[model samples]
Target: MYSIHRSFADNCMAVTAPVRSKGRFTIGCDIIEADKLSNRLVALLPKTLDLRAANAVRLGLRELLINAVEHGCLEVGFELKSKIAESDDYLQFLLERQKLPEYRLRTVQVEYEIRPQRIVFRITDGGKGFDHKHRTHKAREDDALAHLAHGRGIKMSLRIFDRVRYNTAGNSVTVLKKLA
Candidate 1:
């Protein structure tokens, strides 16, 4: 049996469930501030996690969260290009985004479920969604750019997760990583 309890912290609502068995654990659903979600996640990571795996998870989560914040929530796609450009070019690009005031009201929902076998993370945002089918197909078909800096987060996520799926609207991603 699962019991649900609702609470609030840091200006966000949370639903939490406590597991009754040794192998099972806690499940948490939270609506978080987009700007601080990554820091909260980084603080929550278990100390015993494998260094490489933990790093990959951290990087992937950070990038996705940033994408959701800067692009999805703020409707600022040009900010992403700044991340990929040369230092001088990036600085100029960032300056442009900084002048816009559309970044004020963005938020994201981050859900976490911890079980004995794996950890599941779901991140959802409010924004104009994308075409999941097209993105998935493109990732699978592109091989010549294996080591390219672009889209590395999605690639790393596919490799690390036991299962990964996106919501129909493409605004949410669910990832499962088996415990080592």
Candidate 2:
């Protein structure tokens, strides 16, 4: 048995409903500006994770959100970010991009679902997306993560979460982690 509840506050509408899965319950959904991700995550994380697992989840979520904002919303590609990684101007570039009306207005939608066994996150960004298929696998080589400026996040998420899936368009990702 499941139920749905909806409410509106501060011009934001939140819907909480259950997924078809037997134990799954939708907690809440939020649409946050790219710039507000850090603050939002900082506030919600403690409630979402046990202290033992908090660090890994925090790292994975941070990486994904950053990718959604910088790469997806702001249209920063791998080559561009990689070049910026080699310079000291990356933060300046990001700040400039964040100030753009087009980028500033873009948002990432996050949906949270809780199950007796696990918690699931569905994060979608208002951007064209990327080629996530190529990055799904764990790197077999020990050195693959050594110098990479990007992509380690997905790999880390794969290790931390029981499952991580990306939509075909790559604009959305669903990650599942078992409850402690």
Candidate 3:
């Protein structure tokens, strides 16, 4: 397995990659501060992944990072009304959360296992967990206004992965997709 770690100079954050590999890969652990995730994403794009999978990887990673930072780390109930008031409200909400002492306690972890046919990406967050059953059912029904704002991530993730699974607490998600 390959490992990489980066400590952001701008903020109270560090990005650590404990494991990364292409063939027969396994991502053991990665800890990234919530505030620096986007910057890390920008830095990680060209180095860690191939060009062919970059777009899908970026999209998937963006959503996962947002979910981890917003809902998981901040414990903000996903609210569609706030989004309607301001397109960037979700981002602002995250920024506010970062100013809080609680944000310092949050970290996002991504683990993976690669096989000949597929790759599995698992993302875990440090936060109060949500009920997976209720969230999944709400997602399936697609009847809530919050679904309009929050549902897109799940839809996008499903398109990018062959299969997706969430832990009972909804703080972790596993995505699997076959290699081309």
Q: Which candidate is the best by lDDT?
A: 2
**TM-score per model over all chains:** 0.64, 0.72, 0.63
lDDT of 3 at 178: 65
Please write out the lDDT profile of model 2 over residues 1-180, one tens digit for every residue.
Answer: 112111112112222223222221111112133324433332343243444475466567767777777777788887898889788788778878877887777777767666656767777887898888775644434557767766577777777878888999999898888865
Better of 2 and 3 by lDDT: 2
| Every candidate's lDDT | 0.55, 0.62, 0.56
* Per-model tally of clashing residue pairs: 0, 0, 0
Judged by lDDT against the true structure, how good is candidate 2? 0.62
Model 3 lDDT-worst window of ten: 22-31
Q: In order, what is each prediction's RMSD in angstroms?
A: 10.0, 9.3, 8.5
lDDT of 3 by residue, 1-180 (tens): 112222322211233322334322112112234324534443332233443364475567667766766667667665643554366565555556566886656666766564545566677777777776666555555445343535566656766767878987789888876664
Q: Candidate 1: which stretches are off by over 4 Å?
A: 1-36, 77-101, 142-149
For model 1, residues 1-180, the per-residue Cα lDDT tens digits are 112111112212122323211121111112133334554553455444544565566656666666565455655454365454635464454345534555444456678776656677787776676776765666666573475545555655666677879998878888877775
Candidate scoring better on TM-score of 1 and 2: 2
Highest-scoring model, TM-score: 2
In angstroms, give how far residue 14 of model 2 lies from its true place.
23
Task: Write down the worst ten-residue block by lDDT for model 2.
Answer: 4-13
